[model samples]
Target: MANVIDTLFSASISRHVICVFLFISLVYTQNTVVFQPPFVTATGPTVTAFLLGNTSDVSLSLRTVSPSNTTGSIGSPSCTDEATRWVLTKEQIGKTAVRIKLRLNQSLHFCGENETSTNCCTKLLCVLEALQVTACVGNTPKASLLVQATINARLFPASAGNDNKTVIPNQVYQPLGPCPCDLTVRVCDIRCCCDKDCASEDLKLFASHCLPGPFGGQVSPDPDYQCSVQTSKNSPDWFPFLCVTSPPENNPYLGLFYHGSTITPKSGPSFQRQIVSAPLPVNMYVQGSPIITLNNQYFSIPQRVLGRCVNGAPVAFLENFQVECVTLLRSCPTGSPLQTLPADLSLKVMSGQGGNVVVHVTDKVVTDLNSFISKNNALSSAAQKLLCENVTLALDYKFFWQGNGITAVTLTRTIGTLISNVSVSLTTRYSAVFLNGNITAEPNSGNPGYQVGKPVIAGTMDNESESIQRAFISIWNPVGDGLCSTAEKKVVLFGKNSTSGCLLPVGQQTPPQCNLLRETVTNLQASLITSTYVAKRGNPDLLNLTDWMNISFVTLNSSTAMEDTASTCSGIPSHQHILVWSLVTGLVEGVPQREIRDLQIRYTLSTWAQDCGGGNSLCEDIQLFPITSSVTFIDIPVITEPPKARFQINFTEYDCNRNDVCWPELAFPITRYYTGEPYSQSLAKGMILVFCFITASILGTPWRQIRQVWHSIAL
Candidate 1:
């Protein structure tokens, strides 16, 4: 019995030693060995430009600098260099590309800390930070020069189970995903207490709350490890025999334990270069991928989903589209009809330092709808007060992007009068503008000529005639009363003809007041015709006839006579018209290039006192009828004299043969006459030919006589 007990104890000790050995081996394999791949430079030269002073292409490169005399492999002691980086003197990020410049022969440095240190630090790797340039003088090419380089070291720590390589989500606390319940822009979702977008005051009024699982779906319940009441069948095999009892907090598996979870799954190559087709070669967006900024954050734009505005909606890459969303404004229940503009929390913008910045700015408390209109207008003070409204009717956004990400955005808002207790729908428009270089001016309608549906570039010429002062051809915008009291300038789009007018209310029409009103309307008409030249391209110095078109202004007197000379006056401004003439220069890639020319602004004056009764004479409370402004684009080509024939034997329709017809319409064999021929002569020739053919056939003439008759008929 003593020998058996000793043998069993020895067997248990052996098993314990074997299990300990396996656990140590697994830890050593995963934590100790750090495998790192070799680094490579980008395929092409970084930036190349043709210097005006030099004939050859001057190029630059970006490269990294390694430690001096380093010989050992990565993660080895001999190759260890913790501080490694390349710094640029200046960096400019444009719409679709980034331009970074470094001084010639700049010093490289190693200053950054290495978080992936295995022994104090991980081994230093190669770096790509350099702008290499080759100078060319006239026809002579110079040797390549390395301008600068950056030193690169390991960035991640050597760890077990591939924990350093796994993708850890940023918003780990929001287990249900970001804003699953927050549907409206700033309004609180119903019964969604977890929604952070809800106001503190608003959330207090909820009748009930929703119950959520632990960690809001982030953690799953593991009944086996949890210390809870359990049935005998579901418990350990000991089943009350040798069972141990402990508090919930003191449970062994209760704190940070994983049973069946795969903390680190098998991973593939970390970096991949995917090739995708795009309109431009520099575009970096892939199909179906979310649009991202340079810092790898998702690029979000304002989107309308299910009739409500969702500000942080992620935009897909390579999507050139426009979406209109209804933006709901909070209405104050008791106070002023206007509510405070809600803060825009969805847009994400970055500055030069690569940090998020707020793009929306609050300038004025109230936006005047009639601010663009002349302050000295004839409309009464009461009528003018009605023009200013605190409502934002339209939002126009222009996004400028490069191949990598969006670089800049422009926002323009149109304000209109907001009425109390009335439902108003806000319209938001989006547009994507392509930028080649650092451009500040508005994008041209077309490159070399004008394109249909684009805003025409109409502006006055500068003193130097080198550039144009841009002025828009706009119509008056209307409001709730359908009056022309809009402050926004609605630009006249090319190929679109529009005529809009509004009633001008008159309070008192004395002689001096009537003259002032006439001047006010006349001045408005003159201001509308502000520009003298229209251009096809952004730059008018191109000197091409199709590039610049002249604009002429003319005034016409109304032909209508006054009803009574004493009571009715005839000085009222009636109509204003802008006649735009455009001709199709040519077709480029199936798109017509319209060369706009001969822009004319015509103003006509008519009688205004006719609206008031002739007996009244005072015209005290009369309102002038609609004062109109119309824009018409004539696309028909102008008629010009036909070109003179260079050689004799003119290609007139009169000298045409049956085989070689001069005119297309008379080319068919059944046609009796050619174009431009005398009708009597053609009829007489046809009769003679028919008579001769019939007589020849009746007399049984030979085929040769018939052929001779055909020739005589031609004569």
Candidate 2:
């Protein structure tokens, strides 16, 4: 009997402790409240609305319920406590923004009857308030404005320590705990979310900045959210982050326009506390299509806008530029002489850079924005007025700078379509190393950026001499490999070749992108490569000084087809004439700039036997033997000298900086190599190696160590 009484006392004590714990959570745990646009459907926006409630109290009984849009009517509001769900209705998302409030009630279970059940305001514990959002409401995108960019939680990656809690991932990310484990931030399928489809119709297209969002949002921990929920299981380093391959193109006819920041122009010229943001506060990200307006007409540059990281820095660029010419008709009146305007559009790459965004060219086309309107006058007047009434943006404009800076106002118009369409190819240098101290680290996995040369490229932002092989084109000329007269030339094949059927090499399997290019360059007989050249950070002293001057600029476009061809592979038959053509053409920069000369066929083989067909007709008896290599470029300014195998460009400091002192090929003494060498490569190499060793021994660079040093420095 005494033991039974003790047990009863213990049970009563446990019940009291439980009630106290629940009370503490109800009273002390703070609540976070916010509003979101309802998911609209064909019928209407779904009533399932969320009132995000985040607290450390961990009381599972709390829920947001009884949602009421004061000015509107909602289907009897209902909720599930576990998920903080509140059912709203289509009527609640009316034209006028509604003021909605949700009751955060903690289910009461009276341990004792007198525990304050007096105030029955549905026992109003707290409120989750929200304002109606108008955007992201329609089931179909009625406007041309599609998704510009969609970012995710990886921006604020979780850690073994305090897994992404404070900032980084925005507040909206925490609403639905569907994320598997905060390992990656899933980019919501905007197409499904906003009913916008920018791809070829009939083919349900879903795309994303994340490698697999279109496939289905990364697998959700919440079974309710169906999709391929990615986890660390796919790849240890795979972290779902924000990315966009090609954002939906805005109305091409509307022309490119900048929705400038909304600001009241120094109201009445009165003193006001400064509100400024620089280096953009957050890791700056701006994405737009390649359509530029000229003379109030939108001309779509036959190019796709894309973002890629080079050396861990983001670069916005355009590629495969297709040219289209059309006359934009002006309408002053019903038949006001059919005022037609001819215009051209071209691609421009703007890298998110620090320091200052300056352009060195004096003659570059400039569009001043000091007194400017947002959209083209060609757009409907009603839309124009609507945009104007939306924001009275303060106007600020200036000339392009001679260095990298995005702070000043830029009109960002388009280049006119010239008769030849030969005036365009721009380069933007991107390096995470430059942003080391200046910008916050924005993580990207698809393009982890080139993994080498950060230390070499860091401090020389202004000096063109400091630039190295940041771009690559894996090119090759096949002699009659009799691969059926087929040649493979691709920078990085994004599409398939109809004739060859093979997807052409993209080299997704190589490390050190330079080598990846070098190893994947399709060869005629044997793969070609350039000799490794050494470069010190900020100085170019190791290679032959003359080679540096005559071909140093060429080094900007340095490339190698097949290296040491004489020693490696046998040449193609004399009858099969070697041909040189461009696989990748630079806009504005013609053949003269990228391909200075045709790469010679250096064919050699190891079999040591010329087992050719008897008459050399069908060649059935002889087995075809050709080795493939990887080169990073097709045709570019190059010096095919044995000791100096590198791609080069004609762009001298003159072209880059517009200075009289730096003329193209001015520093380089052109060396002409005629047909037929007198000596064997072995002898030439032996003598050159000995002489280099002796000279370098005295000059701090041993000829034997040059290769080793460059191997390390390239990183």
- Best candidate according to TM-score: 1
lDDT of each: 0.45, 0.25
Residues 1-715, candidate 1, lDDT per residue (tens digit)? Answer: 3233223222321122212222333434443211010111222222212112121232323333323335421121222112323333322222211223332222223234744433231334343443333233333333232322234443444443642232324222222133333322223343445656444443453424432332121233434544355576678776566544554434332223222222454445547533433322223333235654444565565665444466556666434455665434333122211222435423555422222323343222223433322223233344322222555434444544322334455555454454323222334444433331122435556533466677867776665334566767876554445544543346888888898776665554444355656776776666566777777442233333444667787777645653435334566666888888887754432345566657888888776554444555645575645668889999876567676675534545454563364554454333644545766776677788889989977777587789899999999
lDDT of 2: 0.25
Against the true structure, candidate 2 reaches a TM-score of 0.17
TM-score per model over all chains = 0.41, 0.17
lDDT (tens digit, per residue) of candidate 2 on 581-627: 22221211011112112322232222222233454343333233343
Worst 10 residues of 2 by lDDT: 142-151
